[model samples]
Target: MISGLIMDIMGLHRFAFHSQVGYTWVILAFVHLVFNWGKVKAYWRHRFRLHPHQDLPTPPKQLQQLEHTQKSDRRSLFFSLLAMAGGFILGRLLPTGQTVDFSSQKTDGGMFYHQWSKLGYPQALRAILNWGEQPARYKTYGDARQIELPDPKGYQGLSLESAIATRRSQRDYLNAPLSLVDLSRLLHLACGITHAPGELRAAPSAGALYPLEVYPVVHRVEGLQSGIYHYAIQQHKLELLQPGDFRAAVVTAGLGQNFLGQASVCFVISGIFQRTRWKYHERTYRYVLMEAGHMGQNLYLGATSLGLGACAIGAFLDDALNHLLGLDGQKEAALYLITVGRVETG
Candidate 1:
């Protein structure tokens, strides 16, 4: 029964890859059993020689054929089973994606291996075909009233140097809602419309294509209900995309990371490559990520200046998240998320 569970655990990648390696796991399991059998026989023989006649340690001979095996095999079987149980528990309790690598190179210090993103133009095209959702009818966002602060220029860490020096990602946050003035300043500094008159908001774009969209998940902001609101750059407001913080969905979308659910606010950045891909085709994905990076850095800097806590989260269930935001994830693909709040103090 335990081995059957092990097979299932080992065969996950095989099934996902659609490869014929599932049989290999079975073979490896047997090879492991055989290696242990010899070691168990040696240990048992020594035990008998030492005492002239003594029963082997508990666990019986039913598991891994240990009636005549060496001592090491018995020990190996016990340790292996213990490890398997621990691994099974960890695997079940954690996000199904978590895993531990026991490679010597990793222990000695080496780049941790990561799965390549299944990103391809084909996948994007396939997703786009399913993008049959009605076009978003953007509406005027929250009731925003501009208010004055203690010192407009003096608020954010005095100099740009200090702000940059202290620009660190923060997860701990306060409970205070963002003031309207602070909201205006943060949005204006971070990815707000710039340069061109009545047009051209983002600082840089693939052919000024500006393929990204920012949605704010307002949880405790003042004058704003707990909801997901899209930032309308042109109109200078937050359009209610979907109501409520929806932070719980974000937690799932973020692979159940605890930080996500705890965040006071989060920005969902999506890309509509059609704004650029119409000309670049497959290569447009690269530009979209780069543009999103620019916007993300803007948020980081803006948040640092405002002295509010912020964190840029990249690992997320891309497809699942876009669906939460009512996006088909074809014309619009979720690129990244920036969660913000007050700094938590011990």
Candidate 2:
């Protein structure tokens, strides 16, 4: 999937190739499941039936039984390798003349429009009529300590035009700690609530679903311990989620981008798709990604206005980041990241 996405982003027409690979992968996966069905069933049975206080199952009893188990393991490993080889051969032997015409493809404004067009008229009508009420505006994490952000209205910053004109993807940062005030202002401008009465935010949302959530990984912020923190939009506060410096892990997850470790703080924007999916259905995915882009721009501009350096990052290990932030990949997943810090000036 990641390979397909990279190919698409680079305008490489390899759909036929990817399709063959996908078919081969499915075949191998099916064979694997079939071969391991016995073990799989036993594992699940033990997982469900065993009491919490019960001891783990003992190993094979006799030497003969142990030898038999080792033989089975060897056979499984051999078959797995054979399946991989077969898959490679099958993928290579498949026809590949049918190439996708990237140039001739019609752009229907965006993917959201294309997805909407696929829905039946009756379903579309029902969707519009039954659009569910907005979900909770703020996300809270148990009894985590919250630090209220500074009032955004009182923030002092450069003009929008000035920020835009001078904005750059800054990769170099000074070895200086970011002040709490600067961090608060940056978060407020990026996604914090702008109007409390209407539940509106600094960034616009499709249908006001506002599916995006912000998390800041602190490294060198003054008056704050290094940890992962979630932003609560309703109260405009930061809730501590995990406490520890994770700059090294973050850099590894970001494909060894040393600059990420150097930054004072990194903002990770995640999406909870169900919020918008209730109304837009499949179109919600497109809207969620678009929302991330909007927030990225806001972060860049916000950082620029505050005389700080910022860079938006997209190339990172998805699963690694999801694990680091303690988010389930399906429900709430990391979509984008931005690193911010003071720019070094000689």
Candidate 3:
């Protein structure tokens, strides 16, 4: 209990230690029950009148002793109940605004959101009565410089099985510019629309509502300037949002992860939650994060297929990244990042 309290104070997780202690406690309790099995049986038989047919006459002194034992047991049970009630009240009195990361001052947002988004009777009724209107399926940049990408098909390198087998989280990268076609292929396979008719994408999205938006922070790619570009998924083109070197900015936004600056491109995946929120309601957050994971895995496999290194990064300054992509961090926010780069191979 003291160790758990210390961990809580330090903002470190105590689940592992709590789990071990819980198991040990259960084993010790079982052993205790075994050792006192005879006494337990006697108490149970007396309490339940196990032998109703047999009338066992009791001595006066023994009867007094039995009554005293029963009173003590009742008192113990009463005190245990009272202690539990006190603990519950104490938990209710504790502050709920505690921050998760001491350095960033980032509160336990996930836990807060999880509790807020629970589907109770009232929430279920609200969902049924007023399902909000859905947002547009695709995001576009009107005046941004558009770069037509090479056909994302027919230029495959490795087989599906081979790609899966060789897929790894590679952090170390070589200082080499990636081919334009390879970049195109990576973006397409990550989340591009594979089926044009229904707007189905490579990564599976809940309710066919693609809430994710992909932005590539380009470091070095052939024929493309070092800048931040948004992937126009519908047209399979790149829309250059900011055309300048962003290696330093990206490195800072990624919490000083130098690999993000060294990589050929870092794909920043954001979610416009309203797209899924209209339909999924309370569970929208869960679905949006799951979709990001699906897209990240796709990027991993795609990079592996092209014999390149790929690393999915979840640790980063959320506000800084959203600012870099011109997102407001609320209606639309960055959720995941994947860095793809050239690597030495045998």
List all candidate RMSDs to the true structure. Answer: 18.5, 17.8, 15.1
Q: lDDT tens string, model 1, 26-82?
A: 789889989899887876676444333346454544433434444565678789899
Off by over 4 Å in 3: 1-109, 115-123, 128-131
Per-candidate TM-scores read 0.55, 0.65, 0.67
Q: Which ten-residue region of model 3 has the weakest summed lDDT?
A: 5-14
- Encode model 3's per-residue lDDT on 194-251: one tens digit a residue: 9888989999999999999999999999999999999999999999999999999999
lDDT of 3: 0.85
Q: Please, what are the lDDT tens digits per residue for candidate 2 over residues 1-346? A: 3343334333233335775777899899999999999999987564444242246555536444655655676678689898777766755674433334434655333442443335443334334335456577567886888887767668668899999999999989899999998998888888988887788999999998899999999999999999999998888889999999999999999999999999999999999878887778656778899999999999999999999999999999999999999999897899999999999642
After TM-score superposition, the amount by which residue 163's alpha carbon in candidate 1 deviates from its true location, in angstroms, is: 1.9
Off by over 4 Å in 1: 1-158, 344-346
lDDT scores for all predictions? 0.66, 0.81, 0.85
TM-score of 3: 0.67
